[model samples]
Target chain A: MSSEISSRGPADHDVRDQIVIAATEHFSLYGYSKTTVSDLAKAIGFSKAYIYKFFESKQAIGEMICANCLQDIETEIRTAVNEVDGPSEKLRRLFKASVTASLRLFSDDRKLYEIAASAATEQWQAARDYEVRIKALLQDILLEGRQSGDFERKTPIDETATAIYLVLRPYLNPLLLQHNFDHADEAPTHLSSLVLRSLSP
Target chain B: MSSEISSRGPADHDVRDQIVIAATEHFSLYGYSKTTVSDLAKAIGFSKAYIYKFFESKQAIGEMICANCLQDIETEIRTAVNEVDGPSEKLRRLFKASVTASLRLFSDDRKLYEIAASAATEQWQAARDYEVRIKALLQDILLEGRQSGDFERKTPIDETATAIYLVLRPYLNPLLLQHNFDHADEAPTHLSSLVLRSLSP
Candidate 1:
């Protein structure tokens, strides 16, 4: 059978997705150490043994849930940046997309984010890798702005990008988890304005 | 006997200090949920019931730990601001002190900070009070800068102060606990520079 036909015909993918979703909710609710694989299995109406067929371990399932959420955010950011007209517009769109994505994912699964944050010690490598990916994307935008002569050239693009990341870091996770998006709105505007002005000739 | 003499001697003072120090370490290592009155007492070589003499509960001890840390930080920021002559200098010093204080306290007792953050959920009113105290201090600095004509009126002083808080927030307790402070040297310097410039006429 063709690869598409074989993969699409099996209910394995659907079950796996359901398992991941349930795991994300449980992990977000109770945190990592507090969440048990058995609880997840039951939540998704699967036996403990059945869960093993889809995931190698609870950590592996947790990783998948986080990866899925991050990948969604990355896609939204990439799309926002590409569709925008100029560096300033791109930056604004990207910031808005990030805020929206964070709120959506975090609000949907606040417990998972809390658990992931709490288990940072165990997931440091994964967290670092995710950050590096975000930094790289921001760097690309800064470089594009530089090439277009729309942004100033005093600071290294990478450093500037990291600065943007630092400014946005606190708000991204909290905007979604809390209902205080209004309280957080000014930071991004101020941060974007500051970054843009610093890059201005 | 004099009131001071009845209150405590040098030996009792030493014991109280030791208990607080021990409690800090235990909270930092084990976090609030895992930490117990018995554990704290054992750590400090006191009876479990005796801990109540100094603190009403583990929750009280956690609050004391946070309050003590924030008080030290508040004093440091005030002193640094007073010694500096201008907004630019004062801003940099303030940022440096904030970052250093965060790294020092969290790096020294990661578990304690983690416990303290978790305790915020358990005691929401206390956490909100702590947040208000810090925000008010920041607001005072911004207002002072405005009055001295060191900062411009691009934004309301209170809003600017809130923006600064959001920018510097990730360096505060919970975020500090989540990330390694080993890269303190590499965080964006332009962040402070940009904020100061934004506030300047």
Candidate 2:
């Protein structure tokens, strides 16, 4: 099989989407590690070679699914933060929304969570990209807060953002979430409050 | 094999200590997961039944070793904090010292770190007890800071301590340390400063 998909046509895009959808369903039912490329091909009624034309490997497919899941969570967080008024409120909303979205994924689609957890634990590019995006969003909020005279400008934006990201890592990281699962709801609120206090001008 | 040692005499204590010392050396050399009870017994010149008299299982030996490692780290942190004058300084030292001690384990004793990581991931009683003790230490420091007028008393102490513990969890938990290893040195300084800023009266 070619290393590249080799097709950019609308039909090919549809086939790619179909493969992802079918693979996600198969992985959800059978678990990610247990499901093989052959199983995916059989479930999707495609030849193994045909599946290979659209994807390089099982992990390549998993990367796409993991990215999609993270994207959905990011969208939810952004929507929640945007719905709020001030930077402080937005930061609080961001924290609460992030925990809510993550816990939902953990409780609702645990099989998908296993894939994301592996992506995180293994340091997959998808997980790294997601981390960069989340940190960017945080820095954006910090910049906004500083400009609006809501947050203190004494601390460097990047360092402050990294610290906040580290604080939120336990809840967002699937491997660490089992220990923090019971505190998922209240911990965010408490942490955001502490963080907001530090951010106060 | 008997679950209990059945003897509280000094001889029994020495024998138990010898088993732990031998098991630790064996685990450190061959790694934890790869070593078994029979291997440990063979290396220690004890029968498998003799080894079981002192510990219930391989994991029990692992628990003792893990507890010893954590206890060593905690002693280092406490010493660093005690050497400082003010609560704020002690708090900062706590973070720095905790990170330093943990990173030392991660780098110098990685074989043992595997055991600690497993203990954390599996929610072992040793890990839980370690967490409780660490949080208690944080709470004690927070209380001192508040009483001495160095920290704000607006928030409840337990919640505040819990939040700070969560912030430090990534650096301390071996399971989560793989991602945060690069930042092990600087992140603690940045985070402790952020936490201290929030604590300021």
Candidate 3:
């Protein structure tokens, strides 16, 4: 989606898209905290006023970039889970894929990861929304497992889903993930298996 | 226990104790980030060189303070676990006590908690040592449970302890705890129960 342009005119959309692209490049190269709106305008050959027309603030642009990055991770997790059969296998794949995708971001695109970390520390809407979606996915998996007699139904689905989310929260939240990244490679297998064991009837 | 004084003379111990007390008072009053070595020196009626003689730097002082804070939480956790008879109950109490002690620090001593948060974020020796202690405690609980025919013996004790510690990491690490404090109350109960369920023989 284009940025803050109120109108749907093609030219307006083009300008918004160009600004986002330029900002992403600038942010990646110099890092998010060091780059300012003025630096972005200079790098993108746009006036400060023009950039502001599309973005309300530097954090606004960061929010958009962070949202896109989170979406990429979500997509990878979904694809991995989809290839597996049974709710148990799907949940296992989901945990592994989630950790792998996030770790890749941390190693491959560290600058972007910084933005996500900041977003999480600030409790930005994007970070909160990402958590909500992950919990919803967990609930869906738990419901599926219950229906198939793969998981126990004694624990309320909502509490079960929330608990599972909390277990995964450290690895999912970039701020916490960076600290625990060393153990992350083996964590998914161990954690998912343990959780699956708990879910058994 | 005193600062870097090589000799264990009573006067050296007194000066070190004075510096620590003054620094803690300053930190609690103005927050760790806002106060400086010079501020502590001034507050304690000591020369800046004298303060540095005791602590290599501001962070060195912070490390001691942070270590003390973590030890307080550890003591609380141990007392809570010891009050229980069974491994399951002990583990559950350990989880709850850890969260409660940390949350208390966050609420009652926000400034001190900031120092602990900084220590965790920086991965100071104090923070790492605290984690190692907690994991060791977890291993002990798991081993006890296994011995009593409570926890399953199928999973390796080391691996299971590590997994449980990871689950509890967010609630224990002050940097991450601040973000998840909203869920801290219910988390220990739900999480410990889930973990206990998995451990059942």
Q: What's model 2's lDDT at A13?
A: 87
- Residues A1-201, model 3: lDDT tens digits: 555345557886788778888888889999999999999999999999988988899999999889889999999988998898999999999889989998988999888888998998898889889989888888888999999999999888888887888888878889778877767988998889889878978
Q: Which candidate has the top score in lDDT?
A: 3
**lDDT by candidate, in order shown:** 0.68, 0.87, 0.88
lDDT tens digits, residues B135-169, model 2?
A: 98889899899999999999888778878887887
The better candidate by DockQ, 1 or 2, is 2
Candidate 2 residues lying further than 4 Å off, grouped into runs, are A1-8, B1-8
DockQ sort, best first = 3, 2, 1
- Name the candidate, 1 or 2, with the larger lDDT value: 2
Q: Per-residue CA lDDT of candidate 1, range A38-125, in tens? A: 8887777889999998888887787777666677777888887899788888887667677777777666766766644533446544
Q: What proportion of the true contacts does each candidate reproduce? A: 0.29, 0.46, 0.46
DockQ, per-model, please?
0.26, 0.45, 0.51
TM-score of each: 0.66, 0.88, 0.85
Q: State the lDDT at A200 in candidate 3.
A: 79
TM-score (0 to 1) for chain A, all models? Answer: 0.74, 0.94, 0.94
Give the deviation of candidate 3 from the true structure as CA RMSD.
4.3
- lDDT string for model 3 (B132-158, tens) is 998888898998999999999998777
